[model samples]
Target: MNTINTYRKKRFWAAILVVQILLFFIFSKLSIAISMFERFFEIQKEIHQLLFSWIPFSFGDMLYLLLGIYILYSIITFFKKKTRNASLFKILILVNIFYFSYQIFWGMLYFQKPIVEKLPEKEITLEKKKELALKYLEKCKQTRAVVMEDKYGVFQISDVHKIKTEILSQQAKLPSFISSKKAAEINSLKPSLFDGVMSFTGILGYYNPFTSEAQYNTQLPSSYIPFTLAHESSHQLGFAREQEANFIGYLTGIQSSNPELKYSAEYFTLKSLLNSIVYEDEKFVENVISDFSSGMKRDWAYEKQFAAKHQGFLNAFFSFTNNLFLKSNQQEGSVTYSYFIDLLIRYEN
Candidate 1:
């Protein structure tokens, strides 16, 4: 009993120290490091793209290997003659500290933010903004893209049999090292209470855009879930640039036969265009609103509801992160979401 008590106290303090060091690194050294590499971050991003593409191994496999080693260590400790409950307590605390600390460090350093340039207010007339939205939608429709799905409650596509692997292979190919199990894990996720949830660490989802497998909170509303899933899943596949991921996710979701997923993609794409036109042309905005389908109108209403319900924390944190990404990457309003500008430009050309 005394040994167990002694072990527990030591483990607790050690965990506390681990957390302290993690915070210090994030709040101090990380800021300095980011400041120093503010100019080189793009290069780093490019390097990451190359690495994920060429490495041929997924972080999922690496995690499995790591966990296996940890289990081995635990087993060895279990069999050791002098092993005690105290040692087990110490190991558990240490593991927890390391997991959360790594999460904090990754969130601070690599999460992509939207662009922070001042958005033009009262620039585009409502008519013009609507027009541009319709134009984009027309093009999207012409592409045979099945816009993202609705919110509220609906069925999602999770079966591999329902999707074409060739199309997936073409859209955003995964590393071979990505185990079938991990791929299934991604595919098996249903529209539960956990989709699209905002994390306490300011992570909108799991893909830090610079690290291992990406994950989203799963508790988000239905309309946003497919897009968010596609967004972060793009990151997992190693597309680090937010614009690229957004564009890819949009295209991929549209190609999917799932109704809910399709609407989600189209909605966000239209929303992006709407937000973009808010600073540009008026006739474009007018044209879009006039032509939208009734289904779209209903979807927009639900979207507004979802936005009203949870937009406070998620929106504000995204704003802060966007500003950080722009300042760090030498771009102008948080350019994180501004990737849409490039997408619009590319699609237009």
Candidate 2:
């Protein structure tokens, strides 16, 4: 009886996995199905935010913590003769439930449609990328001077709450052709509970599909927080692609009345543009970096110091795993910044 029941358990999850894989393949090719899923996501996001957004703390982070603990407990008990079968069943059930929920909530949106298809097509060129880089470099310098700074002269957001408000406001203003999803007004963004560890992992922020919450590391340098919020909030807007989120974030921030949000967004664009052109024209990139104003230089220096402090094996491992995760979801991977630059250049022209 025990062996038969165990076989049934394995078979049930195997069937679920096969069904999900088939659905994913179909979704990738079926626009109508993808559109239906996008609508489902809108309804799901509303329900999730209603349940979780009111909590001042991160319920999603706690959910992750408890999940980790449960998994660890299962692993420890798996070696025990009396508990091995039960532990196995528990983990299997958990995996199946989470996988199915994740797909139903967020995974299908990755296959909906690429943002580039909605925009005017144009030839991407090296010259155009360089021009944007110089433009953003100057913008960053000017914005940096205007935004508040810390006692040490590094860039600091004057008011995080205002930035959050501005990001939400700007979301509603995004071009209809770009993002047609209903704009979310719920303040679901929260600071992560794993911020101490996230700093070393190089994760800026992540959107929680299950809870419709955006989680950012509170430990980030002040300059990174506002733009990171905008970027993560883009994910909440149903953009599953990383670069698309960045592009949406750029749109969200570039038009904001808040200087704090504008400075962070402009700086991020400058960095992305520079990264895009550095290999093609290293000299130009260096010269542009050298031209940073004293305030911008101090801000850059502080960022470098923060990154240096957290550099280690964990950063590399997280980066590698993150790249794989992105690619699995049809993204261009974290190592590539040109997709956002591609959107930028095409949109600019």
Candidate 3:
């Protein structure tokens, strides 16, 4: 009877897993459902941030740690004959709960109308990208001149507190025509407990859907930190597509009064535009790099060195997995910058 009951429960959850896949796929196409989820997310995130924001350390990180241990233990139990059936039941139940919670809390937002639909569309040209790249390059050089720097002369963010405040205030400044989502003023950005591991994994930061927290790697180059926070915070603001989040983050940063953040935002924009143009004319890309201001050059070199140091199986593996995850969520995969460049070029025009 016990074995029979275990099999029954396992089968039920397995069925639930399949149903959830179909349900999310179906709901992803309905504008009405997407609108409802968008509203629900704003309220749910507000509540969750209110509950979890007080703790200085990341509760989401701890939750992930515990969840990882549980998964490992379940796998171990699968190998033992006495516990195999029970373990299968538990695994199925866990998977069902996780998938349902993920879809409800964060996944459905992926189906929201693409931000591009809200903007004026124009034909993007390589010349337009190159022109914008030069414009941003000059913009970054000017912004970098005023920001604080370390003894090494690399750009340093003296206070993350100021950047967070600026990001919140800038949220309202986002063009109403593009994004109308409500922005909550909670400081839920956190330095991840897994920063060391994240450094080698090619991940700068990530949003914790379960806890309504934004987690950034503390070990990143100073220039990357402020923009990374803006990007992850975009996720908290209900923008799910990676490139859309980047666009939104760029909007927030470029509007900021804080120079640290403005410089970071401008630098990222310069890089993104250059990335889109690199394949068409390699010499043009090199000339632009050569033209970077001395200070900007130092920062760029450190970023390259950091990327080189982390090159190994770990980075490659994570890059592949992240690409797969993005595509699974209906994004243009991790390797492409064209979506963001398309948005940028059209917006600029």
Candidate 4:
């Protein structure tokens, strides 16, 4: 009878897993209803903010740490236990709960109307990209001249707290046509405790959907940090897709009165534009890089060094995994920045 009862429990959990998988397919078919998840998003933000905003450190990171330990412990115990079926049943149940929670909290946002759908459709030309690249080049040079530099002549943010404040303030000013979500003043941004891992993996920053927190790799070059913060905060504002977050981050940073923020955004814009056009017109890309101000050149060199130091098999593996993850969620992978370039062209035009 005990053996029969154990088998029944295993069957029950397995059925729950099947139901959860079915729900994913069902949700994937309902883009219209899934878009409505933004309404629930506001409530979720409020609850998460109330619970996590006052915490000094990343509450979300703490949760992740605990979850990791629990998963490892479960795997170890499963190998040691005689009742392998029961252990499998427990694991299945845990996975079901996690998948369901993820969908309710964040996964559904992937089905929202694509940003490309909101823009006027037109073929963007190579000339237009080149023009924008040159335009941002001038902007970067001009902005780079005014921002503070360290003793090493590299860009350095004077006040991170002020930058965070500026980011929050700009959220209210985002173009209403693109985003209508109310800008909440919850201060849950935190530097990642996993900075070493992040640097090696090429992950600039990430948003914690469960805690409504934005985590950035503080160890990055100053030029990358500000824009990364804005990008992650874009996710906090319900932009699940990476390129959408990039576009929104551009809007937030470009409009800032803060010179550091402006310079960072302009530099990233110039780099991204040049990267997109480099294959088509290597000469033009070379000229653009040559035009970078002395300070911007130093920052670029530092970024290249950082990337070189971290380049290896682990980086390749992470890129592959991230690409698969993005594709699974209906997004272009890390290898393509064209979606962001596409959005920039439409908005700029």
Against the true structure, whose TM-score is highest?
Answer: 3
- Model 1, 190-246: lDDT tens digits are 222224445332344545333344445545545566677777655544344466567
Q: Against the unseen true structure, what C-alpha lDDT does each candidate score?
A: 0.52, 0.89, 0.92, 0.87
> By summed lDDT, which 10 consecutive residues of candidate 3 come out lowest?
340-349
The residue pairs found clashing in candidate 3 are none
Residue pairs with backbone overlap in model 4: none
Against the hidden reference, what TM-scores do the models get?
0.49, 0.97, 0.99, 0.97
Which candidate leads the pack in lDDT? Answer: 3
Model 1: per-residue Cα lDDT at residue 118:
19
What count of clashes does model 1 give?
58
Task: List ranges where model 4 is wrong by over 4 Å.
Answer: 81-83
lDDT of 3 by residue, 176-261 (tens): 88889988688999999999999999999999999999999999999999999999989999999999999999999987889999
Return the candidate ranking by lDDT, descending: 3, 2, 4, 1
Ranking by TM-score: 3, 2, 4, 1
TM-score of 4: 0.97
Model 1, residue 38: displacement in angstroms? 19
- Alpha-carbon runs more than 4 Å astray in model 3: none
Cα lDDT tens digits, model 4, 40-118, are 8889988998999899888899999999998887888788767566677778888888888888889889888888888
